[model samples]
Target: MVPSIRFALRGATLLAAVSGMVAATMPASAKAPFRDLNHNGKRDGYENPDLAVDRRLDDLIRRMTLEEKVALMLHGTLQAEGGRGIGAGKAYDKASAQELLSRGVNSFITRLGPDPRTFAQENNAIQKLAEATRLGIPATISTDPRNHFAVTAGASSETGGFSQWPETLGMAAIGDEALVERFGKLVAAEYRAVGIQMALSPQADLFTEPRWPRGVATFGADPATVSRLAGAYVRGFQGSADGLVKSGVATVVKHWVGYGAEPEGFDGHNYYGRIAKLDNESFAQHVAAFDGALAAKSAGVMPTYVIAEGVTIDGKPVPQVGAGFSKPMIEGLLRGTKKFGGIVISDWAITNTCPEQCMAPTAEKPQGYAIAMPWGVEDLAEEDRYAMGANAGIDQFGGVDNPAPLLAAVKAGKVPLARVNEAARRVLRLKFDLGLFDNPYVDEDEAARVVGSAATQAEADTAQRAAQVLLENKDGLVPLSAGKKVWLSGVSADAAKAAGLILVDSPELADVAIVRVATPHEMLHPHHFFGSRQHEGRLDFRAEDEATKAVMAAAAKVPTVVAVDLDRPAVLTLLKDKATALYGLFGASDAVLLDLVTGKAKSQGKLPFELPSSTKAVEEQHPGRPDDSANPLYKRGDGIVLP
Candidate 1:
């Protein structure tokens, strides 16, 4: 049995007593007032709160073994039961946390169990484990957008735990810079409350390709507009121009370079849809958002999963490869030209091998889906892929739990030890800058108090209302009387009545009819539940289609209003002549739409992208260019205002 205290020991004596012993593994003889990391029997410079941030970071890095350094530069999320990415899982438990932390994982993708309280509790538990480790390095938690109502596979979460706001596209439609900033501040507060120090969001991808699956999350197609909104978003998350506040989440602005301009409008899941023929002229518009984000000093940036085909930087041709592995794009452009000092994380699973079916398993490829997006170097070994990305200037690996490959690469001389040290240093610097090392745990009571607050919800409602743009208010048919009889489809009758309109089942018996239609999409991966119907292929809808014809027939009988949820810029030519008024909504509630039409809220939104005049124009337009559709029905920023 060990003595309770070596009270008189100092310096050499202390070192001799604690040799080969880890502070965390020892039994408590006397409870420590403050943690004595490394069994030193006293606080070290790295553990000293008064020490400078860089000094603390250096001390900690110097003490870390190579394995620990590799762990610090790697990240992963808790897998759900049956291999799903979300939902309840044993992965959030202490055992799993210990396994990952013991391997030196200093960061995690957030995996809150159910509610805000649970989220706080689980994160606290994880932080406690980290605190007890030999180095006491706190794990920084990061997450995709969770404060919005839209759900996509592997992108965002369901909005039950936090305040629900308009999607990013909806926020852009409102065009209020101040309001956008407020939304960012609110999201940052909520994230901090739940112990999440990093935000993997504010997608800087331009809305150039209308048929692109992720446009619903972008801030439209125009460079200037998106650039402004992206900058405001970064400010909100990062706090004032000076630096981050305690509540701020270090925003990781994403898909650096051009992810939205996929060839043929397909997503990054396949090789055929990579970014191709990207010249300086077209590339400038795509990088505009990143430039804006960089100006705000975003904490980090994420590369795209698809390869950039034939793209050039500084008049030099870039090899065809994913942004994570491309030296010219990431090193030449983002680092050298833009002079970005922030960490660069590869998109999820970019270093893994592409299984037969990339992405979540679907009925077409039932073998099980996994997006091993080793795009340009599909033939390279997995370890070599990781080494290549790190050597190319990527600082961290996303979606990887094992650090053995990185360790092996260093041992084999594929990646220099100095490079590993540099990568680990960048990641640690972010943690130190965010103040996570000092206090990584959150207050549960505070989390409950601030998350989903009434004021925040009201602001979301206002923003949603503003995002509803009047596209074609022919004959001033809007602001229809509250007492008017209304026939509605895709809207709840109770909600319509609450807006002061009398609900009617038949269009012929009603004074006016309203129908809500979603932009049509072809189903891609049906088996991935939340990720299914990921719209791909054609972007047009015909009037003669069964669903379109039925809605039009009802709309023909009375003065009609149509609202299209423009996830993608849909062909609106068919409904132009038949409807009395047409509106565009990115993502909103039934009551918010009623509020706008009933004059309770004014429409301040403008078109973020063009509405193609016909399906043929959509087919003929270039995927890499924005606002190039021939004879567009409505150009970018076009919004009809009615008295």
Candidate 2:
């Protein structure tokens, strides 16, 4: 058990009625106080574990003032801009973090886990500060997906030394329900070890659109596959196959509905990607992908930023606004039809202003950092945006620290105080249910042993190896002989030596040439900060490209073996004729690849999605259709095996 500074009860006790039950008229000395929440001399009804969760929430929410309630509805980040990256701060920033805690905001989306032990220490300090507040509400630390192999910049951050596994698509490539669930449980153990109680992940978005920048994050284009794996992910993370548990990480299944149907493959983070082209059938399929996650009783659901264009639900035309600002998407669709009773958190920075810097770098703000995504409600004031989102059933606002606008809106009668209370109940219920109110601290020493341990990493390395799809092996050329003369590209010499392979100076001098390459993409929309980093446009490689040129030159002299990381499906027509062998990877280390090559580990994955035949076929296919392109170079589930 974690040791905490317990506050002693004072001289007298005050009998009070809370959650409609009167406390027995007795001395406070009858029982020991539970952390002295509300800093009272006696134990409150909310602090008593004997009471039910709903009743405890009722007692806590009624005690909270309007300011405290508003603060509960607003979630801030460790960073001011609310971006993604690993930050290893040995000490907590009192000026930046304490100010928010003082304002009664205890929840934050933190990206501070550099390692297990250091991350635990940083989180403990923050929780201690929350315990010092008047109500002593424990801090609920949340994070982006950080246990992945190849983390994306804006979508998911680096693994922070956690056990590295293949991307979600790779899990789909392997399609093992048990293995995926094991990965989830392992992730939960590591996260809890580091004092993180909430996970803002398990993105249930489908990879329907071939060119979508964030498609790699999804399981696959198939609704059933995505739904099945996403549910397994939530079940594992939340520690129950049915619902949330006390020792589980509260999982948030996110970007709810149609985030993967971007017409031009742009993300909703920028203005250009705000409109998602969705017909009625396409939207239904998209919604179906989240069935498994919803069925697993996930603790939280985040609305997507994109507006569902050309769509309707139950014969009613959906509102032509971003899902965050639309009542039909939140209150009607998610809560009413789908029956999702979880906390509804809005995506980050939806209410902030999209100034020149947000759109593009201007002369005055050349290094633009602040971001906003008020896609359809740009005309409204900041306070109006807050009221609209709250009324639309947004339980919490992510990325923004201050609750002044919400407080102002409530005072002006724009938003009802009752709505804020409801939001507070939903938010506080999670904390209480997770036993955060009881024990929020973690053991730092335990964290060091659990996170990134060899046992967990061995399981992940197996997944990475099993997820690689062997696309081609001409004349049974795979299972390369270890002693053969080999030339490497994107592979290290140490890894080669470990695999017992002889290395040569050039591809011409070697018996076989092994080259690694990534899927082809164009950097379109360079003006926007997110778009500049996004993988958009063409998926076919040109002859002038360095990797393509090297492949062409090497394959002419030796039996060239190519391994491409399939973040997004690239047209493999260019390499079909030239290469003797092709291996498609979602995420794998040089050693994992070498193990597969030397027959130490057997290749087991099939194509998660089809590889397109040409750039013209990519442009012509519908954004919401799965594997409907003209004559795909490789069909879905296509793979080869060594005899």
Best by lDDT: 2
At residue 585, candidate 2 shows an lDDT of 94
Tens digit of lDDT per residue, candidate 1, span 1-643? 1121111212334544564355455467533444455556666777777898888888988898888887777878754434454434433656666777777776888645467777777778778777767677878888888877667657776664688788888878877778888999988998888788898988988877788888888888888888888888988988965445655888888888788887657777554455543556777888886767788888889988766654577677777888899888788888898888888988887888875555346576652445567888888998999899998988999988788887788889999988888888889888777777777889999888888888888888888888877988877888887699988888778889898999887999999888888877776545543235477766677856654775687777988888888888988887878778888887788888888888888888888889998778888887667889899999988887555
Q: What do the candidate models score in CA lDDT, each in turn?
A: 0.77, 0.83
Candidate 2: residue 449 Cα off by (Å): 0.7
Instruction: Estimate TM-scores for all models.
Output: 0.92, 0.93
Clashes of each: 4, 0
- Candidate 1 Cα outliers beyond 4 Å, as residue runs: 1-39, 80-91, 111-113, 359-364, 524-533, 544-547
TM-score of 2: 0.93
Q: For model 1, how big is the CA root-mean-square deviation?
A: 5.5
Q: Which pairs in model 2 have colliding backbones?
A: none
